[model samples]
Target: MQNQGLLKELIQSLCCLPGVGPKSAQRMAFHLLQRNRDGGMQLSKMLARAVNEIGHCRECRTLTETELCEVCANPLRDAETLCVVESPADVWVIDQATTFKGKYFVLHGRLSPLDGIGPDQLGFELLEQRMATGQIKELILATNSTVEGQATAHFIGEVAGKFNIRATRIAHGVPMGGELEFIDSGTLAHAFNGRREF
Candidate 1:
């Protein structure tokens, strides 16, 4: 019924999260209600605060509560090398997994015309402004290995060319411990084509 109470409303609201189907939402909602209402309340408060306070960093467009994100704010970070990624989460993941000491630019998404996402939506103008500042000597395209990601990187590379900035793509190939026999043909081809002297 449209007039279902708070319990139903809570379950429906929980379904808004990614990968959270109705069953998952229901389970979560019931778990919170039955066993951990206090934890749920705490989570609710934190989530509310994060959503309400978090805003994009002025320079990199990553989610931050301040004018600049930690990376952009750090003076020790390399201003000459900027990594372009598809999401704020990518910035976090790359920082955690790699030794990249350069800055980052979060695109939030790739160029997908069918979904109506374009350069404007991804804040290409802001990126161009950063490039125009003449500080970025190299742009590292760390976007996903999908077709749209490649197209986005290509478009950004062309933009970098206009500013005379060097652009490089992060390699997408076999994992460090992946066996050649088990690796897929596409990955093998990419790795073989991208091979360099030992």
Candidate 2:
């Protein structure tokens, strides 16, 4: 029975992943043990290696295997402009979608006081130290549109302002090709308010 021994342990272990329930984990365990043992072994090895070796970048706090992330090490990237984001995943998304040549600072999460997450937890001390260096000319707040994200951006903006560095927030709105009729009201309103002269 899956509840009795190693199968139970495997299922419980897989359930640690986001969105993976007992049933889903059980299915995955069964699939791996039955038809894809080699693939499962590969996955296990890779996962272990990634977990053990991957670490936060020294400068930007993004996931990396070295002292600094590729962006931070690259000479071509603009060091004067830095994009601040909520997570390491945000860095990947922004890099692939935009032509921005600026450097990045991964916050890893926004401010959420209720949950006891503060600037210290999100590496704001490091960010402040970077700002104190005066190498950065602009701080781009690319945080999410949520209330917590907005508050986090504002807090960082204030910090940048104290150092005379310009801070700008990323514009939020509807998708590029989305029709107004199908778009959600909140996004539509935000888009209208953010509109500028073409």
Candidate 3:
């Protein structure tokens, strides 16, 4: 079945969102047109505003409307210990999960040379500059457990070592309450390597 021009355009645009396929986009378009026009309009306006105004924080590289993010602006946060993450979303997760008191540095992406992403693309230069300031005493690498993430963490660790700053990777292992049988080999290995006396 062929949709009218505007409806088709709307569905197509919705499909641009990650994990949204044509059918889901069509359902969303229909839902917006038939049941929730007000909500849809609000979403559209907010999307436009965010797209136009939101930008990376200069210090941490997280999304923000101003030069620095709220975390970077707050004076009470621990400036001597920085948590390095793969993206802004990780920052939010860490904030929600732990009682961590440090500032953050968002890489925005992991190292992927095949896709041409490298230190420059991941904002390593800015990170180095921050390290050179002698304000950060330690770096906590919270990058993902993927190959690229590990490689990125190693690269950052080497860079931190050059500046005489300590760096550590977040522990990867079987999650709390997870059975050993269900855990992957890599995670099990990491768990063994990161093990400490109980």
lDDT (Cα) of model 2: 0.95
Clashing pairs in 2: none
Badly placed stretches (over 4 Å) of model 2 are 1-3
Candidate 1 off by > 4 Å: 1-4
lDDT of 1 by residue, 20-46 (tens): 999999999999999999999999999
Clashes of each: 0, 0, 0
Itemize residue pairs with steric clashes in candidate 1: none
lDDT of candidate 2 over 24-99, digit per residue (tens): 9989999999999999999999999999999999999999999989999999999999999999999999999999
Q: Give the Å error, residue 195, model 3.
A: 2.4
Best by TM-score: 3
Tens-digit lDDT string for candidate 3 (1-198):
665899999999999999999999999999999999999999999999999999999999999999999999999999999999999999999999999999999998999999999899999889999999999999999999899999999999999999999999888778999999999888899899988999
User: Could you tell me how far off, in angstroms, the CA of residue 103 lies in candidate 3 after the best superposition?
Assistant: 0.6
- How many pairs of residues collide in model 1? 0
